[model samples]
Target: MKHHYWEAPIVIYLFLGGLGGGIFFLASVFDLIVAPGAGPLFFAPVFFALAALALGCFFLVFELGQPPVFWRVFTTKTAIIKWGAVLLTVAMICGFVWWASYLPLLGWQWAAGLAGLLAPVRSLMIGLAGVAGFGIMVYTGVMLSTLKAHAFWATPALPVLFTVSALSTACAAIALSLGGAVDAAGLGLLVEELIREIVHEVDIVLVIAEIVVLLVMVLSFYGAGNVTAQKVAARWVRGRTAPLFWGGMVGGGLLLPLALYLAGAGTAASEVVAPILVLCGGLLLRYLCVYSDERAPIPGEERYYERLKSSDTRFMTAWKQGENKY
Candidate 1:
């Protein structure tokens, strides 16, 4: 059986982590900066970001084979593990502060007390979270790309693709949260138009950037001339993985959503649908990426197998000796 070490948990981690990081990231840079007095920043989007980040952290623990083993990430200087964790931890802390704005409504005096305690240093936390958020957004791709054995994932463009996708999904999540808050607040069309405009514009740019990175990753992987790289790229372009790769990711995720955003041209429903499609595409892309990886062939392995399959007694003797079975 083939050894595919990455499981569903890793996929989930990448999706949620990227998404959560992106929400916190965009919230710090875009929404918070632009909507200073807007309660939606505190009451909804930040809560959603925290929730997504927390869940992604859970998945990360799950993938560790044992939850307690998570500490090993910190105990050692494993760059990916240590840094990805720091991103999640810092983002969660900031998210909690922002999300805590709802606590008083729930009659939680403890949270109100905590909120007061946090007020003085809140801006610093948000800033730290944004830096961490940027790390969370890109680290998953970096983690995968560092696996030099997987020619499919070992590209610089993988991180770029993931970063763009992360930002795109984050924008979609924020738009949804803000939309709900707007309806609840009974805001007028003017507010709705502004939010929609922001979402539509940002999503289109992020989606376009993601598509470009994806194209570059795939083309470069195939064009590199490594037989293993060809096989990996073939999974997307010419092999069994094509349907989901092209259909789900390209069609449903990117192209269709892009078309919807452009065609709807400001319809609220289209704006909503556009993000959902992009979010779904991001998910499907992650799944395809984890599942389609074929580890690079071992050096001299193809030749060894070729000779072993031949009716060459000398090759058989050498193979048996190498296996210490002679």
Candidate 2:
């Protein structure tokens, strides 16, 4: 039996953290455009992005078994994990500072004053958050791929692949919110009329990027000859995990959503459904990444089997020759 130290909570952390980070990064770019009403428009995704990040952090702590242990990553030289911890903290702080002005209940006087004072530097704050957000999103995949022992995840393309997925999921998240997918009763809070426009603005491009990146990642693995790599790649092919991989992540997550967008059928219903599919696909993709690697045989196990077969082949050949002589 293999030991999978990082399990579901960690998976959740990767999924949500990457997602939130992508949202922050995208929103930061939008916030800087400086259109007359663009501040309010971009700020809508800020709260959701912050919430996603906070929840991702919560799951990360949950996986650590103690909240205090998470802080240790910042103090240690754990590479990507350290980067992730610091980046998440910075992004969260900036997101909070930038968005707190809109919240009416949290000591509005000081918060409002702070927001007013920071208004001049709002773009700067958001810019920092965007940088951190990009790091946080890419770090999740980089950390996994850094596990050199896991031949499945040890890839040059995993980081880029995961980044594209994160961006796609982030767009889905924002589209979902705008489509009233979360709370139809709170429709007034959303600009439903902007749903198709948002999809056209961001998601269409992201969808194309995601498809291209996904193809590159899979083809890279598929073209590899390593037994462990082959096993991981097969998880999405004919293996037992293929159904979920192909059906959940590829079909529902990428293809279906892509089809909807290309057909110009991105109605309010699709605005809700497409994003949900993408989010589900993103979550399921995490599961596939985790389990596929975990399920892969340990390195050298295949060599051991091959050597055993070689010995068997030699013994059978000798036995046949002996019988022929007799």
Candidate 3:
């Protein structure tokens, strides 16, 4: 039985969400390791990170056809979805409380101050949230890998690929946000300095690794000759999705971003153009992956399936018809 192709927006969301969650996790780790008591600066990213994570989950829900039954996943006591739901809820509450305490309200200020006293507790919670977020980030990729239908996504490296892409995109998002604050000179400097000192160098290495993994994955598919995998590969090479797969995902997402970082663009740029490009590239990669995956033909049956008009619809109709006939 065939399935509808995963849509572009869903793919983009998956990529961005995973990347965002993973980055948030990484940031929490950083806060624990480097800036032990840095107050708002440390907590602000965590807040944004959790918020982004929740937003990503919303996208995933929409992508999954908005089934009424979907909520059942949340109710299952032993399900991973339940764990993810609980973790996300805790993260949101902790993040909001941590962030709200900084707002300049009269009585609220005092309340915030009182909440601030719980920083140590919040820190621990954020750390655990990071672990949960990381699981969610990697789970999406693992989910895909489990689909024996798409041999292209079956590799062990796919999960790691997703994780790396998530980190790269997350950093891109943070960089873009920080860059937007360029007019606030002091804040801009702090943002830039933090990115330069903490994110830039490490990201360069991460991007390199992402590129390597992508290359290896594609090559492995080429070597395998499985029709489904080849079809997915074609999307990256010469199909309608090729431009995004090659240009945006590879060139813009990995290569150009890395080049800019290595060229010292992070500290030197007055405008946010470079970081924005990276973010766009990351988003494009996600979009491309989803599009490609949806269109990917089943292995060993490409010719028979390729002749069918409206592959997705035809496939699904055939599936339903077969089920009814059976």
Candidate 4:
């Protein structure tokens, strides 16, 4: 069986982390700047962001196998994973608190006191979470790019691609959940519609940016990168991963969604169908990138591994101890 260094868990963790970070960042923009008096309108998105971050962290720890070993990440200051862990923790804590600040709106008497206590510093907490969330979105791609051995991943475009995709997906998520979460009056309903419209427009731009960055990254490697990178890029361009890359990501993920958003604008096709496709594309991007880890092997390494694979399995078991038990 062929072994993969990073598996589904890592892909999931990266996707969820970027998504959560984007949601938090956008929520902060809406609450603190876009509509300060309408902070409660974003309560649902913030909650979803917190949940995503928490689940992403859980997957990260679970991927470590021995979960206790996850603590070792904080013991090192220079490691990229260490910084990611810190950012994730900070984003989660602050996001949770910010989300909690609106609990009284649910008519939960038990949460009224907690909500009141957090009301004073709610904006501050949100600001902190937004910063940390942005960091997490960038960190996901930066972490992959830092692995210099993997020629396909050590590129500048990856970070930009991931960030843009994160924001786009987050915008979609917010648009999907924004209406249901709000309990506003006549004017408030108008503001909600305006926010949804803004989100749709912003997502269209983000999707375009993601397409540009993704193509630049892949085509650059395919055209002029080293042998290892070229091989990986080939897989994405016209080889095994081509269908998913072109069909799932480019066609369905980017172009179709863009078309839907443009045609319907803020209608169900744009708000519902397009956003769902964007999210799926975002997840597929992570899956493809994580699996495209191609390490440039030293001389003779490839042949050596091939020889090992072809070697007779019985040869190893054929040997016995000095007792001649064979």
Candidate 5:
């Protein structure tokens, strides 16, 4: 493998992309089934989820090599792509505004009173924005998977995998933030109860699925027998990227979370410790994936092949001329 650096912009792009897409998807799912009369209590998750998605998008735009070029995606005559981009932009803005007005007061004395008044309206907008954001999140995965050069991320499963990981990470973030708030308010028992009831079940399932998908992905690379793919897999298993693949991504993100959930299910001690440990592990995975030096090809590999048309033409002409003399 060649020595390639994973620059800061690329790292930010990976992290923000996953974080934003995941939060948006989770919020959408919740709004669809849980919103109608779940009360203002539900909004705690909704508001924070949207805020995280918004912050992720902010980082994405900030990391762009040419920030001004981003505007061109909207102005261009490309209808399908333009519409998707426009929808994401609109949803992000609306969701951010809503979250800003709601999340800060989750622990306030008058939170229930304030949310009681605004719940219906907030639920409606949150649902609409969440749906649109889900599409955008999936689109981010498609954008990466389309790149043929980086075989590691070229599989159709990349989008689905990204979606799952994103959702899991967002859930971890919510748990952590809520835990911190609960601790500050001296309500540690309530926090522990919440973890047992909510975080344990949902995150356990998510982590298990993530681990399975990761294994399948790695195995597929080994079976394919492509040199480039094999090289990428080697990097993941033993080279510079090993820490991310093993320690941060697997150990911290999936294994640790799964162990905590198992411990909590079997004993009382884990009830207090599992969620906190899982939250830290998830954040560490996010940071590693963002900062790791792994380069997957962009969506324009075909364009690179197209750009070498002259070389192909010369080779074809020489072969034809040589054969004609015989």
Candidate 6:
């Protein structure tokens, strides 16, 4: 009956938040900068980004135990969770509006009318959403790093790692959906090829950056960290968590994708297989970080908790409210 403060819901929430945020940010770059007049090509990714943000919010609220009062997050101005709520809300709203601005290109007459009305503020919404999206990507890591009790999470390198990973995965997601969206928009093969080349090239750099950062974080902890951090680093290095960290994350996630991008370049291996692996690695990164909640226990704490009956039994079931017979 091992228990931790954060669990699966939090993990999913973190992963989805970064992913959704990254997608929105990259979508903005593609639409407004990289390929202007190509807004129609981004409809699918924007839709998926909005969905991911909504789903992540749902999971966050579900994990709170008291869903009815989730709005209380806005009441506290100083709470980190409050900042996250605000960023997520702003990103989703602006992102949806930005996405809607291109509906006319999809042959929706009703949407065309609505989009015309939205034209004036379209660029503003996209810019705002991009700012908020970047905020969410950084916030996920900062939230964890701020938890000082967890030796493994409280590090400057974490936010950097998460941000790089977020952008990398976002590129992968965009690559996966680019072809279909291009066909839908009739944007032509030239545009699609240009966008695909840009995304794949960017992803290669990101994967390399992630590998370096991850190695530095682990090796630093193993070398100079405190007792708990060293223990967790050991688990990731030569201990039980080694296989997944080295083989799955380092090999399959980073190096293999790099090789695929360089060698396979334009083939399905680079476009499809590599991106999927990058996504899996992104998810695995969050899963590992969330589970690395091993705190440095105080003296006598372990023995005291081990001897407590409440640790093994449900305290509420020990007695009924009015059934005391003593």
Which candidate number has the best lDDT?
A: 4
Local accuracy by lDDT, each model:
0.77, 0.74, 0.62, 0.88, 0.58, 0.87
The digit string of per-residue lDDT tens for model 1 on 211-317 reads 88887888777777477778878778878888888898988999988988888876765667888898899888898888866766578876776666686776578
Model 4, span 1-326: residue lDDT tens: 12257889899999999999999999888888987766788888888888888898888888886898788889987889999999999999999888888887776889988999999998899999999989999999999998888888899888889999999989988987884555888988888988888898899999999999999999999999999899989899999999999999999999999999999875789879999999999999999999998787778887887787579445545554334335
Native-referenced Cα lDDT, model 1: 0.77
Per-residue lDDT of model 3, residues 213-250, tens digit only:
88888767766647777767765778766777777778
lDDT of 5 by residue, 208-308 (tens): 88788777876677667366667666767787778877887788667876787777574643444554555454455445433322344446864675667
**Maximum-TM-score candidate:** 4
| Clash pairs (backbone) in predicted model 6 | none
TM-score attained by model 6 = 0.92
Instruction: Give the clash count for each candidate.
Output: 0, 0, 2, 0, 0, 0
lDDT, residue 18, candidate 6: 94
Q: Give all TM-scores, in the order shown.
A: 0.84, 0.80, 0.77, 0.93, 0.68, 0.92
In the range 1-326, model 6's lDDT, one tens digit per residue, is: 22378788898899889989999898788778888756666778888889989999999999997999999899978988889999999999999888787786666788988898887787788778888999999999999999888999999999999999999988988898874543533445678778888999999999999999999999999999999999999999999999999999898888998899999987999999999999889988998889998888877876777778557445534455554433
Lowest lDDT 10-mer window, candidate 3?
176-185
* Candidate 2 C-alpha RMSD relative to the actual structure: 9.9
True-vs-predicted CA distance for residue 290, candidate 4, Å: 0.5
Model 2 agreement with the true structure over 1-326: per-residue lDDT tens digits: 23367789888888999999998887776556523234455555777888989999898898786777677777877577888899999999988877765443333565666667767766777888888999988998898889877777777677887887888888888766542222222543444445436655577677777777766776667677376677667667777777887787778888887777666454854667777888887888787787656435567876786687787886777778886432
What's the distance in Å from true for residue 67, model 6?
1.0
In model 4, the runs with Cα more than 4 Å from the true position are 1-3, 312-326
Candidate 6 CA-lDDT value: 0.87
